[model samples]
Target: EVKAIHYHPENTICDCCQCQMTEIGTTIVREEAEFIPARMEKVQHIEHAYECKNCKADLSQKAQIKRGKSPQPPIQRSIAGPSVLAKVIYDKFVQYLPLYRQVKEWERYGLNTNDKNLSNWVIRASHDWLLPIYERMKNIMLEKSILHVDETYGQIINRSDGKSGQSNAYNWVYRSVPCQGPTIVLFQSSLSRARSVLEGFIEDYSGTIVCDGYSAYDKIEGITFANCWAHVRRYWLKADSKNGRIGVKYCDELFRLEREFKHLSPSKRRKKRQKHSKPLVDEFLAWVENSPFYGKNALAKAAEYTLNRANGLKAFLDDGRIEIDNNPAENAIRPNVIGRKNWLFSVSEAGAKANAICLSIAETAKANGVDFYQYLVKLLRDLPNLDIHRNPEIINNYLPWSKTIQAECVK
Candidate 1:
């Protein structure tokens, strides 16, 4: 498709001939992209009803009336539609736009709606439609053998636990390793960052968990912790001493070896690490144990931290599927962290949970190369029609990696 730029009648005349100039053909001078600002329009549905004439003619007989099937609104008793709700979710979760700001954006589009109405739409949609999908994602994610876990701070303004709402809260993120399968990033909002939080999320599960040197992950039964080497390097990086430099060197060498073996098959990668990385690991641990610094110094602190979690740091050697760092989980959780900076805090605990659900869907869709807005639109439009709660398996068809979903939602 092509668009023509029109000139004024006076300008269309040829200056040299003083005659009218006509377009013989078009020239491909240049090409550029254009953005059209979005505008809103009102949509009204008028369902037609039909009645049997014969039955109507017989006054004693009841008339058979049939009504046309109308499409359901994404949210009942609200003006919001599937596309509208998708935009709100996309702006707030993906673009990090807050509700008050989005209210202003709606005004620009000639729709005057307050932040309270927007919040209600999101909360109701998440509770009614999105929560089922979130749960299904969680169940499938936990089925994978290799998982990465991390957490960051979150706040809520209304308390449910009888404590001040201003008190601290946390958002825990768990994701399946990319190598294992289609990545699933799930977020959980909780009042505590205790080990119990993680334990409850992965109940009765047994697998490798790659994570930072957080003590809360220490000795959870049936779980193997592959502690992050990058975290260990951070301690050494902060230590302002000659030995600290040596510690960093050891870490760097191990990382370099991992990068070289990145393209190898898991079994082959395991072989390469055992042959090359194991020696460096042994040597680095020896250096940390024998370091001269002690008591209140950076070097001592680094060594103590290293030796304490030495086993977990070495756990990656036995399995190639586990990464040398928890960077995947960190990168996954960073969106929420960045959004937290903009939105500030959830108005209530329920709102925080809704935030987690929305973020999970958006991030999971992104990991699978699906357009976030399109995927949300798909879910919001389709899920309402399915008996998702009774037949939970129906959600499997709509997951980010499903064949139909990939074809439909990936851009």
Candidate 2:
């Protein structure tokens, strides 16, 4: 319920005047200005008339004003500044917000805006302003000694086939040198084939790639694959749900190994695996080889799981450089999945590409220990004047790993 408070002026006698002073009324003043409708009035022009009486002729002169070129009206309708616009775009595309809902929220505030304009701004700004940062991030990722690669399905509308139904697409994210910063995310669209996207992104990247058993990653040449232990354990947990006793034993063993892994830092974990975990891995392998667990009805499942992922599991034991899981890549891709729930799908190929670029910057900023909002604002403000070839430092500043340079210098 809304309530109004009224204040009445108190009547007092002026001692100096020796008369009663009646307070006629009271006025209320507001501390802050309130919003009022814009007042627009039509302007009128009047001409002055002059007469020359000496020449017996009446002359009328019209006012002729010298006018310069009219300045273009500012875009007053925008409640958000360029920085705010960049942030909103990042939140909507990288963070994910449906346009229709954003429109409704703006309407509630007495500001009228359409989702179409916002979408166009996001796409145009991402392609024109943010694409360089995205490219540089990918290049940095390729330079890393270790990387994780993964792909997830992305739905799209208005595909090339002219079909009304949604199309199956993919977002491929790659991160390099994740521990030391400057992580990168690369997104690409593919029908179903993962090899093409992975191969294309990591064409020159030859190093350890941690991934799941997607089979499509097999096509990459000279690249060592380190399988995720989480995937392996997931299978064991599933099997335990059906076959109780055997499943429980395997799950307990895997859980114990993971607990050991959690106690070490990323770098220390790698070294500890070589020291203490190697012996355990050897014993586990020998047990698998000798036990009936590999000979029963579950033999095929156990064999396939052990044989295919044996190298990946042992890689950590042999070299302290490999990770036990492909969690970094999965963590990077998680945001895109959550965003899909809100925005649903991209309208076109271009829109998807834009979404990928914005997400790359946001995620990379976070990885580099930079604020996403501040970094995005800098991108929007400085990108228009940025010359990528000559002014490569601008690109470097946005890289997650490149932090020696000061923020003031980039601006």
Candidate 3:
């Protein structure tokens, strides 16, 4: 049972006459949310000490002694606890609170921590603690037959040169399609937008990737490309005022047909798409081929854009698993876009890569119905005690889809 201790003021003496003032019985006059200032304390953990004084005095007898193992620090050798690290990760990443802003907040809460320490904890935790989960998510995503991929630009401060903001990078997102098993979004940070990023991402995996018609994706062989119709519609939308009505009408008819196949089984969906949607796509491509417009004309260029990507655009027609567009990948990458505004840029390419790893964990956890704070708390608390190298299966237990993780983190 819990009990409350009520505090009351003592009887006051009159300043002038030294007479006791009237006293009111101790009772709470008001109940309100109390603003208790944050407090910090250094806790000394004492290991049990065992000693036999009689044996110690006896030279012939050996002394019996024992000292317990010390508690592990969340970030090795740092004075931060698991909950402290969780709050730091949550505020900086999930809440998008910048490090400088957090410094002031922590100061108010009696921490007085600088940005460097915070950055150090994040980088170390991300690399040593979170990366295994990232790799696991990456493997699971690559296991799928259909994946959606997209790219977004981000800045990395203090590049190879000393000065900052001299270089740019891309956050490449690879994720499973909606029709797949457990959803996972993996972020990769690359200094260049070269096809090598995609090449290394899907090295041996030969699967259909739905994406926008970027030439980088075209260079990768042994993979089927399904282009985004949303991208195509955006082109038409841009040119709508300038003779894009016909193209817009064609896109509308195509989407209308697509909605009808939403709930159909894979094989059945493919059949329905072939019967009803295939002709519309073929007719749309024909219209583009029949019409001629110069690059200067917006409407003509939109038509030509569709014409050039027609092969990728119609890829979904061959299979039900492939989506008409790569919007899911775009949607998955959007959180990075939102986070880019806050915290602005990463300090280095290495830091940018670390950011990707952490983001992959956060986004993948959300996709798998895992609570963000709970996941970080568990990761920070348990990883210290776990010998991941000795037992490779331990990390698997922490995966978002695992029963342990789900039971602990899913809300």
- Which scores greater on lDDT, model 1 or model 3? 1
Please, what are the lDDT tens digits per residue for candidate 3 over residues 1-411?
Answer: 434667645648888899888866776567556566767666776788788888899999799787787767667678788777788888877888877789989887788799888888888888888988888778877888899999999898767645448566789999896678888889998877899888998888888889997888784667888899988988888885745877888888888888989899888989999999899999888877887766776787798789888889989998998888787898899888988999788887778887898888888888988998899999988988899888878988999889999999997
Candidate 1 achieves a global lDDT of: 0.90
List clash counts for every candidate, in order. Answer: 0, 2, 0
- TM match of model 3 to true structure: 0.87
- Candidate 2 residue runs with Cα over 4 Å from true position: 1-81, 93-95, 108-111, 161-164, 241-271, 289-299, 400-411
Q: Compose the digit string of candidate 2's lDDT tens values, residues 1-411.
A: 434556754646776986878767766654454565533233233445554454444245544444433222112343445554665675685556777777766566555779887777777778766787777767767777788778888877867756554657778877765464545666655545557667776777787888888887664677778887767666655554344345346535655775778756677776776666677667665765665554444444654676677777676665455667788889988988888789788887788888888777777666656666666666666555557668876677655445532353232
Q: TM-score of every model?
A: 0.94, 0.72, 0.87
Model number with the top TM-score: 1
> Each prediction's Cα lDDT score?
0.90, 0.66, 0.84
Residues 41-110, model 1: lDDT tens digits: 9988889999999999999989999999877767888989999999998999999999989999999998
* Better candidate number, 2 or 3, judged by lDDT: 3
Please report how far candidate 2 places residue 140 from its true position, in Å: 0.9
| Candidate 3 regions with alpha-carbon error over 4 angstroms | 1-42, 52-62, 161-164, 241-243
User: Looking at model 1, which ten-residue stretch has the lowest summed lDDT?
Assistant: 1-10
User: Relative to the unseen true structure, what is the C-alpha lDDT of residue 30 in candidate 1, on a scale of 0 to 100?
Assistant: 73
